[model samples]
Target: MPRKLKVFRTAAGFYDAYVAAPSRKAALAAWGAERDLFARGAAEEVTDPALMEEPLAQPGTVIKRSRGSAAEQFAALPADRPKPKRVAKARTAKVEPAPPPEPAPKPSRDALDAAQDAIDVAERDWRKEQRELAARQAALDRERRDATERHEQALADLDRARRRAQEDYDAGLAA
Candidate 1:
């Protein structure tokens, strides 16, 4: 007979992951956790039915739920006192720039063009970085989906093997 399943929960970065499994070892395998989270006090058996519902429904699948909202987290932080405001001194006299009639050296177009080129280069770099991040995110999403598909396939294979073995045993006993 298979072992009875229990719901387990752990706090992962930005989310809490839960899984229903037969034991801590199984849970760890399902969670893909290399270290024993239970031993480190990072994970625990969840007995509460309300919390156990989703995990039980999808046994062995890691169900991640967002831990809390930004607002809630912000509220938890300690309040800092507002700093005193600084008042700027009022200017008694303002120095005006030389009149346009003097046409002071007519700001060089070369310097302006160089600054624009630098800005263009910076913008291009920013865009390339954004594209790389997007590609990475897509890859991560694909990997997650592949993992889930593999898990489902494994479960089906196990089920088929178990059924075939049981049938064979019965036939052998009957013969």
Candidate 2:
């Protein structure tokens, strides 16, 4: 059987989140609230027909309506704000200039020192790794060059051995 749905409203940050649900638990589920918002007095069943329309139309879906933005809230404030009081002073009143503000205390350099130290350590570690990588590259290049030299030498030795064997065979045949 289909359960009867009711519109529920709650304050979500600066906006109001509304939903049509069968129960308070269903409403909380729609709002994705882990705790009981109704128990916390943050949520309540909305009876206002004007506020209920949108939520009832889309049942179980959360509808966020802006209460007021920061600027709008300030604009909504009462325009009859108290004005600054005007003091009656004689025209000959000599107003002494205020003393210069004292120099502010120097800010702590501990955080800066720690950050610099961390950067220095990082740089040192990076340079160490770069040097290790360069050394490995140099070793690899040397090994490659050595292998090429050995290969050429082996080829020359085999060629000479073959030529000597061929010459000996021709000499024996002639004899």
Candidate 3:
């Protein structure tokens, strides 16, 4: 016979325990088993309240139950502290049919034409701006190149004049 397992869910995750086993011990073992599974690489954290009996599900897990002493105790406990939800194996149910599609709205031809015109005008303006920027950049580059060349030439001329003056002074001294 398949062992009746009491499935419990804790804040961390879910675990299964034999119903014949002690509730406290089984719950603790289940908790440890869940932690071990998590350590071994399980991603989902179980957050269901631990089950008190094998045949019965806990408050958060079950939809309805008689308010016995256990329920009373649960209620007596501060409202702030309540049982967590039970995580169970998902039930297999048939999916509902998809909703019908709605009709699509059509745009007017004038609106479409206006949008196209705006896009074309923007593209033309963007191209014109790009060309103007390129021309300005080229002109600045040429100016910088010419200025550097003139400065270099001026330095060379100064060096030549200094050398010639030094040679003339040496010749006069020799004479």
- Candidates arranged by lDDT, highest first: 2, 1, 3
State which candidate, 1 or 3, has the greater lDDT.
1
TM-score to true structure, per model: 0.43, 0.41, 0.36
Instruction: Give the number of the best model, judged by lDDT.
Output: 2
Rank the models by TM-score, top first: 1, 2, 3
Residue range 148-172, candidate 2, lDDT tens digits: 9999999999999999999999999
Once fitted onto the true fold, the runs of candidate 3 whose alpha carbons sit more than 4 angstroms away are 1-106, 170-175
What lDDT score is found at residue 113 in candidate 2? 100
Estimate candidate 2's RMSD in Å: 18.9
Q: In angstroms, how far off is 161's CA in candidate 3?
A: 0.7
In candidate 2, position 28 carries an lDDT of: 90
> On a 0 to 100 scale, what is the lDDT of residue 152 in model 2?
96
lDDT of each: 0.93, 0.94, 0.57
Superposed by TM-score, candidate 1 places the C-alpha of residue 120 at a distance from the truth, in angstroms, of 72
